[model samples]
Target: MLRSRVAAAGGCVAALGLAAALAAGAPASATDRTDPNDRYTAEEIHHFLEGFYGNHGPRPWEREHLVSDRLKERIAQTPGYDLLLCAQNEPRDIEVGEVTTAQSARVGWATITTHWSQSPRTAAFTAYVDLDGSRPLQLLDVDCAPGD
Candidate 1:
């Protein structure tokens, strides 16, 4: 169960555009493309979060980007911290409310609303997606926060 959740969370991180952030050191693949929709799946969000909390690692989502070399060093020092903190634990439940898309010749953006659930508690968040949907769906970025 834990393994499945961790894999799901990793997949979610990859889906959430964090893969690009994490893959900063990886070589580019010929098959790699930047389309937000292709990269993000509504269902994947739930799985990712599930894995995040399940593992008890540091959270990339907790701090936005890896930032400077210092932060990267911190991240590296704490192996699997991000994955364990963010993917292994469950945050109650998630409700993807509505999704809206905006586009131009060069790029595109999507706004999605989601709800989070935990025993005796519930919260909401919104995600903003920017990527090249015309070619393939890849996450550019996301903004999320608690909602009422």
Candidate 2:
């Protein structure tokens, strides 16, 4: 399960017009696209993220990304220490929409529309992931406009 905070280098661009406030990283190939389901399958990915968000149930790619000692400590000590956590803990149902590829063949973003189960208003966000065969699939970034 993925547990690290996303800080992209080149920035993550969302088709929904939300620029992911992440570390801007390598330029993504526009021509290279793959089905997110080919790796983790859409159903599995949806279930995984839902499981992770509700009640801090499961952590995604928690082991593969913890290459350094500091990262390990960070997760162990502060699971709810960042925006990602704040978003995850929202009192809303995480509704997964379309899943599309981004930077690499194995990496893509999921369109999620969310609102409290009791509320009528809804906001949308994209949750990016890395599902390469070399490592377990993980949630790379969770960018949401809480009020949008």
TM-score for each candidate, following the candidate numbering: 0.32, 0.46
For model 2, the run of ten residues with the poorest summed lDDT: 1-10
Q: Write the per-residue lDDT of candidate 1 for residues 1-148, one digit (tens) a residue.
A: 9999999998997787866766777664423442353443333333433333233222565344423344445546666443212222344343344444444423233223222443455434444333332332323333344444
lDDT of 2 by residue, 1-148 (tens): 1333242322343522333322454454322332433455555466656654553322455544522344345446555644444344554565666666543466656666666557696666666666553444566665655533
Local error of candidate 2 at 64, Å? 11
- Candidate 2 versus truth, CA RMSD in Å, comes to 18.3
lDDT of 1: 0.40
TM-score for candidate 2, please give it: 0.46
Per-residue lDDT, model 2, residue 84, is 45
RMSD of each: 15.6, 18.3
Best-matching candidate per TM-score: 2
